[model samples]
Target: MTNTFSPLATYDRDAVRHWTYGTASTQVPIPPPTGSPYLSDLSFVSGANGWGPVERDSSNGEQAAGDGQPITIRGTAYTKGLGVHAAADVAFYLGGNCTRLTATVGIDDEVAPYGSVTFALVADGRTLTTTPVLTGDSTAVPLDVDVSGVQDLHLVVQDGGDGNAHDHADWADARLTCAQ
Candidate 1:
């Protein structure tokens, strides 16, 4: 006599699993900025928040979503940007309407002397630009990438081989130059 078990019997259909990498888990529709091409104003196709929800035009804080302070990096305050934590990904669908993307990337000062992370810009599944390992002591790095004819854009932040502790990251003054 032999006994066999079906894989379907062990599967939990109602269980919800959370993903921290690869694809995003949240999606939101953003209103366009008036007379400006800031990425913060564009709708995000998908997003994954590492710790707290990504903050718009503010620094990643320990508080609830949208409850962050002004985006600050190296003591410099920015009026426009996206505040996210490490192991985060924010994707936007450009539909080939954008030409260039620019931003000042850095580890938010809120976690100074604590967190470390790396920032990357991926266009249509290809890495257009990436930054070196950035720490709280590092100054903000400027990024300028050409996204000509690209349909998808992903702004990613990864923990620098270290645990995601206080890994607050910021994309300051992020903007996209696109056709009107």
Candidate 2:
């Protein structure tokens, strides 16, 4: 069966901004504004561990090289896929006049044994949504958060108590919509 999604937000794609953690070093250049639907890529850092670009799906061996494309849903675009290193916990600082945010989190499919991970959306120390657990076999966990009027939004993914054996966690189709 195929997955379908309702459009999440409406805005001028040309006005959207973009940025990536550290540097824009992924295999695929970050999609242009016309193709993007949000602000910058948000800075990312894993808790004392390493981080890397989200790999292409299993089609590309899920290698730690290229940046994945935005997962479009019902005509709306989402965040490009991103991943972090093993045993690592990572967060993205999505700073803007965010009204709504949505995305999916899960382990990259190419990893062997496919470890576990958790996805959390946080704003001003308040916990918005924390997924139960995601693995290779698990469908991407959906995150739809009401961040209206929020100035700072944080998207975090961490190891799921399994020591990050194959913890290539991905922030798939992640996105933030701001007020006009």
Candidate 3:
């Protein structure tokens, strides 16, 4: 058997870090900033929460299905996104000083109606990268943002004003790198 569980990234002097939300079993509550309402079916978990990459039209309580392990680096399977619910947020910290952050954002291959969600990276109240709209797993949104002298970052995925309908998002190959 393979050890599918691992941290988002393995740290080193180069000050590299990664974020794979569902790799571990830590469940953190994600409340909206202030006026935004809470999105449903979003949380942290390990493995495929028995969800494939398809979102249903009706509200049968099946939001977390389409997300599972994504491509892995080295030998570790990547973690799922933080939402079974439409919108999800995760707190990120870098182990070492870094100048840039990069990642690929998309809805899991197991989910459907991908156009109903949008993934973004928000840092210090600025929207760094926001995908127009995802329709399927065929495409992954690539985001590279300048994080020089920055401390905190927020990974967010939101329902596209469609009331969280079939919104299963994922952030893959998330990495923080320093200027070399």
Candidate 4:
């Protein structure tokens, strides 16, 4: 037996916006030809985010690296106050389970001068292996961490250096895709 219902709708080809940062930015929705088109109101927040500036052993710079970059979701930094990291809203759910996460960024002057976009896998609200921090120099630092056994996976953000603050992360957009 087959049942019929209204079909899922797709946004206008030019309706949805894209944002990004760091280098080779092509995802963020810059000042629109008319108005703001970069804002999102999608449901489902794949997050375990929390951030606060503090003096690590060396009261120098901040963290813009792994797990750190993705957690920053402040809109005041943007032209229209759309949050600092653009990728905080964009996400994908797939395979009846896994929810893939992706992010893109655009650099500006307000960002910390030294840091890297950090990604971490959290299980049962516990700390896991802290992988080597990823620097802005590396783009699209993707993680294939199996979410099949996780209920909470977090992506944090911060800077990188020999305990010195020099780099910054001007984020723009975030997107997600998965195959469940």
Candidate 5:
């Protein structure tokens, strides 16, 4: 579908914000002019990850972007999804044309038995759904959030209380159902 998004006052496509934990900073890329049901097909408006850059269809690895393995949570592998580190917020402009957002979120198996994180789905500025603290050993949390009339959607992953050491998170098979 065509992207009908016009930049809101809060969203600056060229702005960059630095993180407190480390030297890593958020890089805001220009949002795609077109939209797709699959989130991986659309570019993020703004976001940052603790480790490497946010990867598409793969898990966050120790090296560079797109160097991650298949997105796996609790032994289940996903072919399509987003791989991000904790303290990450990936946003997409919906233009109030989307109906729903669905995904199975969890810590990637790459850091199994280790990392901890929390997943939250935000529509516009309000939180729609949030998962409990999820560890590498925890099962994937399924999310189906109503996003109708929402202009922006954010997939946020935060470090669970402790520090963000091994917090590799995944949004498996993430898909958005939008109006045609």
Candidate 6:
């Protein structure tokens, strides 16, 4: 006796040929950055709790500070101007997988360059050659870094300037990519 059973089709013929991408487990593991040691190097070089302390404008203003990571001495972390002066920096040692960095801010894009909102990735409080590259304007804003050959990266925030500075900047959703 022969038995015949139908198997589920993972794909349909000619529906659309696409690369098989492994579904990243929705059970995303939360990267470390908690209390006690407010400055932990679990992700990068040195993580911080707060990155800015600016003044209050008639408009609720805010900006990011800096990032933390190892200046591997082989890469140049670059930052592009976003919305006039908004900038973002990343850690190079974080590796290629550690490219995406997201910062949240609210400030008038027309303000006279009172100060800079620099949310950067650093290693022991300094910008190294291995820092990530930042780009974009205020409209579609974000700083994407390439941390492919790096590790032990951290994030920080700092007002590029002071006095008549703005306030309010919350950074989160920092995703690190790994090099294959």
lDDT of candidates 1 onward, in order: 0.84, 0.53, 0.49, 0.32, 0.85, 0.32
For model 1, what is the alpha-carbon lDDT of residue 7?
Answer: 31
* Lowest lDDT block of 10, candidate 6: 71-80
Model 5, 101-170: lDDT tens per residue? 8899999999999999999988879999889999988989898888888888889999999999999999
The 10 consecutive residues of candidate 4 with the worst lDDT sum are 30-39
Model 6 residue 131 lDDT?
18
Candidate 5 achieves a global lDDT of 0.85
Highest lDDT scorer: 5
Models ranked on lDDT: 5, 1, 2, 3, 4, 6
Given candidate 6, what's the lDDT at residue 94? 37
lDDT (Cα, tens digit) per residue for candidate 6, span 138-169: 32134455433334454444455552243222
Predicted candidate 3 versus true structure: per-residue lDDT over 33-147, tens digit per residue: 2221111222222222223322222121343453334432223334422333356665454323466766666555555434366777766667777888665544666777776
Candidate 1 structure quality by residue, lDDT tens digits, 47-68:
8889888888998897598878
List of clashing residue pairs for candidate 2: 19-41, 54-83, 79-174
Q: How accurate locally is residue 102 in candidate 1, as Cα lDDT from 0 to 100? A: 87
What ranges in model 1 sit over 4 Å off? Answer: 1-36
Which segments of model 3 are wrong by more than 4 Å?
1-85, 113-115
Model 4 Cα lDDT, one tens digit per residue, 88-119: 22221222233443334322233433345444
